[model samples]
Target chain A: MSEEQDIKKIMHVMRRAPHGSIYTYEGLEMILIMAAYEQDLSVAFIGDGIYALKKDQDTAGIGIKGFSKTFMALDGYDVEKLYVDRQSLEERGLTEDDLVVDVEVMDASEIGRLMNEQDVVIHH
Target chain B: MNIGILLKEGPYNHQAADTAFKFAEAAIAKGHKVDAIFLYNDGVINATRLGDPPQDDRNIAARWTELSLKHGVEVLACIAASKRRGINDEVMIEGGEITGLGTLTDIAIRNDRLLTFGD
Candidate 1:
């Protein structure tokens, strides 16, 4: 480790629901790319993007796969680091209890720090 | 480091700018500097001087203006996005400068990291 290896931390900030659009899904795909093809990939859910973390999303009514299920396999991609903003959760009335996965519940300040530490960040 | 904060949607309709600001403020807090915030696609709406939000919503428009005044975060509204959406800055009056792509590239290279946040 004489020379610094490019850790290349990528943070995918998703704040939308599971369907009606491809933004959130596309973001997850990008993170998959980072985790599968690259190195040091992380994700942060912000604003409505945090909604993607709901414990059990019933997307079938909306004609989409319950996205909460895919989140179940995050460990397979080695995308272990997930963060949710405290303010975003409070404003939206969401708490870790409501979420399906364990995420680093941080404030805006912590999320910003995560972004600064990374080599590349993509927000979808 | 090169920090690219992609704004993917309008202020009121999405949280693109709010998330970007949070990231920027946090980056600065940890002693890291944000070189530039690239406004692309719908993200370019943050640059409109004629910013207006509904009475019931928060003022994200004002937040962008404050980033410059308070944090000195260089706001580089994408020339392509700006032109498509109609955003023009002082230095971008002539030629392709109005798009602000050059500023984005400059900031990317100058900063320590480049980040994008699409709403």
Candidate 2:
């Protein structure tokens, strides 16, 4: 198949917080590798996943290698499409300004519609 | 329609595997083809034949094997994830394959939908 035809709209849905478990960190790892493929990639931060984009995270106290900075570095990897759930952020009392990275804050229905359009949706 | 399932949690410890299996079965019943079941993270443990759960409990590995045997499903465990969890080919159940992430990319591209079930 031609390279152009192989480009599928893949969305990685991050639903967990960082540090408490390895899901979010490893989920980011998967995104970084997939970024190299140059596909239509977008990451949705819902539920605890919004916490992953929180600013000033100090993992040194937790003794785990904090990879929250990796989210900031996604732009360099050409995986700039980051979407944060509006309700999730509001429920957590967080706003777009509180995040360390720039993201499109969208409603759940909008994200759900976008998800239905994707060829692949990887939930983490 | 061709569907691919990505199971990210281990059996019993989480409901992900059970949910994925039920979804796969439901998809097949609906006349959709289940292209493959790609196991990542602790989900790789679902492919091991060494599992010997209590008689009253559901044997997750055997369930996957049955799905593969009866429905022609391709059960695959990520090589990188499997290696770290000590799930080699020798311990893999029948119809389960140890493959790379590239294989998952192929499954994603070929399938009509790639549904992921995780904790």
Candidate 3:
């Protein structure tokens, strides 16, 4: 197969909040591993998943290891397609400035279009 | 079409596992190849042979083993997630193997479709 054909557009959809459950955390690990394969990988934050990108998160009191900082490192891993649903952020009273990393804030419809283009969509 | 299933929930507590299994069965019935079932997160618990649900309840692990043996579907559990949940080779049901994320990456790449079932 051609090099271009080998690139599968895989999107990891984050729909749960961080710390409450292991979905977001384990999903991050899956993204990190997939990033190394050099495929077209993207991560979308929707619903409470927007909280995963919120800045200054401290898990010290929650007794769970804080991994919010890991989002900032994803760029270095060459997995830069980070997207946030605009409605979800606003509904939660958060702005792009409140996020720890730079992301493309788009409407849910726009994100849905991108999702349609993906070869695989994994929701967490 | 060659379809791969990524199951992210354990049995009983959620319908994700059952739904994924049914989807696989339906896909196979439709003359499609169900390539494999990759278990992650709480989904890794589905591989335990030690689970002793009430006799009246569906035996989830046994169902996976049957799927693997009868239909040639590969049943895989993420090693990292399995280790964290106290699942190992000894506790794994027949045909269920502990694998890495790299295997999952391959499943995503090579399969014609990769469907994820979870909360």
- Candidate 3 residue pairs in clash (backbone atoms < 3 Å): none
Best by lDDT: 3
Alpha-carbon lDDT of model 1: 0.67
Q: Which CAPRI level is candidate 1?
A: incorrect
Residue B115: error of model 1 in Å? 6.0
Per-residue lDDT of model 1, residues B1-118, tens digit only:
4455556665656666788878888887887776556666566677676755678876665666666667776666656556656677742311112434445434433456576665
TM-score of chain B only, all predictions?
A: 0.76, 0.97, 0.98
Ranking by lDDT: 3, 2, 1
- Candidate 3 off by > 4 Å: none
Give residue A16's error in model 1 in angstroms: 2.0
What alpha-carbon RMSD in Å does predicted model 2 have with respect to the real structure?
2.4
Candidate 3: deviation at residue B86, Å?
0.4
Candidate 2 on B14-114: residue-level lDDT in tens?
A: 99999999999999999999999999999999989988899998888888998999999999998888888999989999989999877787888788888
